[model samples]
Target: MPSMKQVTFRDLWQRFAELVHENKSVLNDLDAAIGDADHGSNMDRGLEKAVEALNASPEGSLRADAKLIGMTLMSTVGGASGALWGSGMLKFAAALPDAPEVTWADFVNALGAFVEALSKRGQAVAGDKTMMDVFLPAMVEIQAQLSDEESLPASMVRLADQAKAWSDGTRDLVAKRGRAAYLGERSAGHIDPGSLSSAFWFEALAGAVGQQ
Candidate 1:
């Protein structure tokens, strides 16, 4: 979700920044045991670079924004999630040529592109305990909710609801892709950090969508 009638590069950066700001500590805690202990730092750094890139160009072109996101994440963040998530955004951004005003179809295509790109890059799917666990199902719900929507805020709230469900659903899933997979059934007790983060981003977007 975005505030403006036409989403600019700045809006994308702001959405990401707001999510990161809110979740930095949570992500750091989540990464402490299962992962490298730098998820928050890495994502914050990546988004900072993304904003810098946004400022560098400031052209409001979707393509430019996409390329900057791709480059920034690839350069700043490490590990599987960084590459996969970064590439997903990049792939979606690449599909648009200019500062095109997006519609429901655009979000659908963008989410589909994200899952497809991450699948191709990571070879994972829903229930894999990866970000795809949340992304795939949420995307499905988003498409269904927005298939006939006229108000952007309404569709975004629907998307947020689905994302919340996806985040909650991750609690019972066993990790199959990341190092957490080694925990086997033990992973089932803890919520997937990636899904939580993804849902937070959606929540922030939804909160901001109607603000303007």
Candidate 2:
């Protein structure tokens, strides 16, 4: 596959920010059921800041851009969200080559590092009714597709669909992490806002890659 340009990569985050803004209320409502009811607003604030930071800088290497976004999010966002996305993205930046463009495999490999950082920091797994519910399975599917020699665009498109289904599947899960954990049995029957936002990230990724 041709290399993924830095511009397109940056657009992925922009698309994600837009998606988050569009669904802000829906995400907050979902959180209202089980958590602080601020997931959407928190993420929106962080992503918007992240995008602004990106826009303020001249185009840079993938690592530099990712690091900028991560650091900006760390400082601007609040709560567990800031820690998770900020640190995870830092790891993602560290995993990538310091180049203006990279292959799809490089992006996916860096994504694995991002997810690993999230898993370790959050200590959550597939059934935890958290973002991992989407990240874990999406990582598995991506690896499988890579092994099967799927095209990058095709794989990302499938990932967007699979992520939504995985996020929706969270509705039946009892929360085992975060504030929702306190609700125990009552946590079931509501979608996890974090998981849905993770789905949106993949949707944004697919759209960005498609444009490339």
Query: Which model scores highest in TM-score?
Result: 2
- Model 2 clashing residue pairs (backbone): none
Clashing pairs in 1: none
Please provide, for model 2 over 1-212, each residue's C-alpha lDDT reduced to its tens digit, 9 standing for 90 to 100.
54668999899999999999999999999999999999999999999999988999998899999999899888887888889999999999999999999886788899999999999999998899999999999988876776332477777898999999999999999999988999999999999999999999999988998888
Model 1: per-residue lDDT, tens digit, 19-138? 886778787777664555667777777777777777777556566677777878887877776798788888977666465456546656766887889889988778887778778877
Error of 1 at 31 (Å): 2.3
Candidate 1 residue spans exceeding 4 A from truth: 1-9, 147-150
In angstroms, the error of model 2 at 70 is 0.7
Over 4 Å off, model 2: 147-150
Q: lDDT values of the candidates?
A: 0.72, 0.91
